[model samples]
Structure formats: C-alpha cells, structure tokens
Target: MQKVDILAIGAHPDDVELGCGGTIAKMIAAGKTVAIVDLTRGELGTRGTDLTRAEEAAKASEILKVSARENLEMKDGFLQNSEEYQLKIVKMIRKYQPTIVFSNAIDDRHPDHAKAHKLVSDACFLAGLPKIETVLDGQPQTAWRPKQIFSYIQWKNITPDFVVDISGFIDKKIEACLAYKTQFYDPGSKEPMTPIATKDFLESLTYRAQDLGRLSGVEFAEGFTTEKLLAFKNFDGIVL
Candidate 1:
C-alpha cells in the first residue's frame, strides 16, 4: 500500500488534467506523491470509447507521473451521490490516505462533475467518522480523512479561491492533456469532432492557464475553489 501526499479525484479520465495538470506536475517535481482517481471511464464522452479514454488516461498519468491511478467504473452521465457511491469513494480514500484531496468543481458544464464533487467531498468527511466503518482487506482501517478537500475549476471558468503558480509545469500539463489523443484536437483522428476537438479549444486551455497565472503574477498556473474560507497557520506558506 503506497501512501500518497495529494490525491485528485475526477468524474472522468481527462478531468484532472484539464483542471490541474500543471499543479500535479509541479507537485511531482517538488517531490510530492500525487495520485488520481477517476470515478468513471468517460464512456459517455462523444469523442472516444471507454477503452480508448482509459488508454489515453494512462498515458496522461504517465506524463504526470502520478503515483497511482484507478477508476471506480461508475456509470457515466448517470452517476448518483448515493451511499453506495460514497462507500466506494471511502474505500479509495482509506486506501490512499492522502493529506490533501482535489475534486471536481461544485458545478460544471457536465452535471456528472458536480455530482462527483458532492460525492467525493461527502465521502471525505464520512471517512473521518468512526461509525461509518470501512475496513480494508482483513484489517479494520483507521478513519483517515484528508486535511483539506478543494475543487478544481473546469469548463465553466469559475472564480477560484486560489491559483498555484505552475510556470515551468505548463508544458507538462499540456503534454498530459494531449495524451488523450482520441479526445483532443488531432487532425489524424478520423473520429468525430466536438467542442473540445478543435485546435482553438486546445489553445483556450493554455490561454486559460496563462490568464489565471497572470492574475497571480506567474507565467502559468491552475485554479481551484475551497468550500470553506482558507485559513493558514502563518503567512510563510503564502506566496504573496
């Protein structure tokens, strides 16, 4: 059981990359252990098949150098924030025991993304409860909850609570996102095109990061939101 320092949970395969690929890359470069959990195979994505997306996601993970990656095999477009879903999330939270967990935004263009956000956030809190009892293998697992859970902005251009400076990590982020060749812009692909398939959409992703970075006086970055107002122990942790 390898432990992770940061764990990112997404509704689909490419979500994490779109939301915070640069941050993950930066964290990895800073010697932090990061992992990703995709709740669905993105079977419903218009651009690619589940198998293709899974392969693409794997390539993305490799590019990001995530410590571990897994899929919950949840139904795409029909996911519910039910107890069953929460338990499944709990199992992974217990298994990974990360200090921080990043999840989908509270609201997004994709309804599934919002649902996943609620499910993952609720599960993180529930996992800290002793009565909710989820054990791993033969061992009675200790209740483990991430110190903080934040939602990464996606698709909707949400106002982020904070943005991480990922100046040097932007290229790595784009590399990871482009690994989903079947989903992104690829003239070579004979597949159908969608909102995300155009070259301009890809360019928008880069520009979005650049825009966010500029707001914080950085070359590139990723944005995220927190449920609660941020409280730091000291000013030393803040960049500005």
Candidate 2:
C-alpha cells in the first residue's frame, strides 16, 4: 500500500480540482505525498461521458502530480451514508493511511456535495474501529484514522475556519481544473451550458481565491472548514 500524508476525497472528478487543487499542489511541492479519491465518476453530468470524465480526471491528476487517484464508482446524484459506502471509504483510508483527509464541503449548492461530506466524515471516524474489518488485495487491512478532516469550500460562500496561502500554485490549480474540458467553460464547444460552464464561473475561480486572499493577507488562497478545532505547534507557521 502507498502511504501518503494527505488524502483528498470528492463527490465527483473535478471537485477537488475546483475546490482545493492549489492547496494540494502547494503541499505536494513541499514534499507532502497526496492522493485523490473521487466518490463518483460523475456519470450524470450534463456534459461528458463517464469515459471522458475518467480521462479528464487522469489528466487533472497528472497536472497536480498526485501520488495516486482512484474512483469509487458511487451513484452520481444519490450519495448514501450507509455502511456499505462507509466501508468502501474505510478500505481506502486503511490502504493509504494518511494523516489528513480533505473532504467535500459541509454544505453546497449540489446535494451530492453535502451528502459526500457526511459520508466521508463518518467513514473517517468508523475506520478507527478495529472491528470494522476491511480487506484490501486479499489481505486483511488494519484500522486507521486520519488525524484531521478538512472540508473544502465549494459553490457557496460558507465561512472558512482557516485558509492556506496558495499564491504561487493558483496557476497549477487552474490548469488542473480546466483539464476537465467538458465540464468547465469552453466557448468553442457546442455542448449545453451548465452553471459551471458559464464564463462567469471560469473567472470566479481566480477572483474567489483573490477575494479570500484579500481577506486573509495573501495573493491567493484556498479556504477549508474543520469539524475539529485546529491547534498550532507554534506561531512560526503563521504568515504575517
């Protein structure tokens, strides 16, 4: 099993790219190993087939240079908080054994996003129970729980608990996001326009980061909310 420092889980393929790709890029650049898990292949999307989405996800993973990327193939619009779904995530948590998990937003415009947030949050807690019993690759997997779970902001202006200064990596994030050509704003394509495909949404990616940065004293940044209170080892990590 490939151990990583961080595991980012999303409801759909480009969710991570749109939400925390800059943060992921910055962390990986700092030598932190990171993996991505898409809960769904986004088969119900207005544009792009499942194959196309999978291909785009692969390209986005390459752009971010993540250690690994996997899809759970969950139902696109209907996410459940059932044990079966929880165990699937448990297997991944055990397989990667990451300390930090980045999950979907607590609340968002998309119903699936909120559902995913609770599902992943519960799985993280359940993964720590020894009796859960998970097996990977025909071998019994040990129980593992992440130290922290942070929910990335998406499709809403929810207040953030903290923000990561992703100034230098915003371009990398945008590149990864645009990798899903069928999903985002593409003027040349004749596909039907969705909320995200609008030109305004494309520009919002940058302006939103800049706005968050403006509030937090950075050139650009990504915001996340945590269920647990965050503690700092020292003030040295804080940017002035």
In terms of TM-score, the best-performing candidate is 2
lDDT of the structure predicted as candidate 1: 0.91
Off by over 4 Å in 1: none
Candidate of highest lDDT? 2
lDDT of 2 by residue, 145-191 (tens): 99999999999999999999999999999999999999999889999
Model 1: how far residue 181 lies from native, Å = 0.3
| Residue range with the least summed lDDT across 10 consecutive positions in model 2 | 230-239
lDDT by residue for model 1 (37-58), tens: 9999999899889999999999
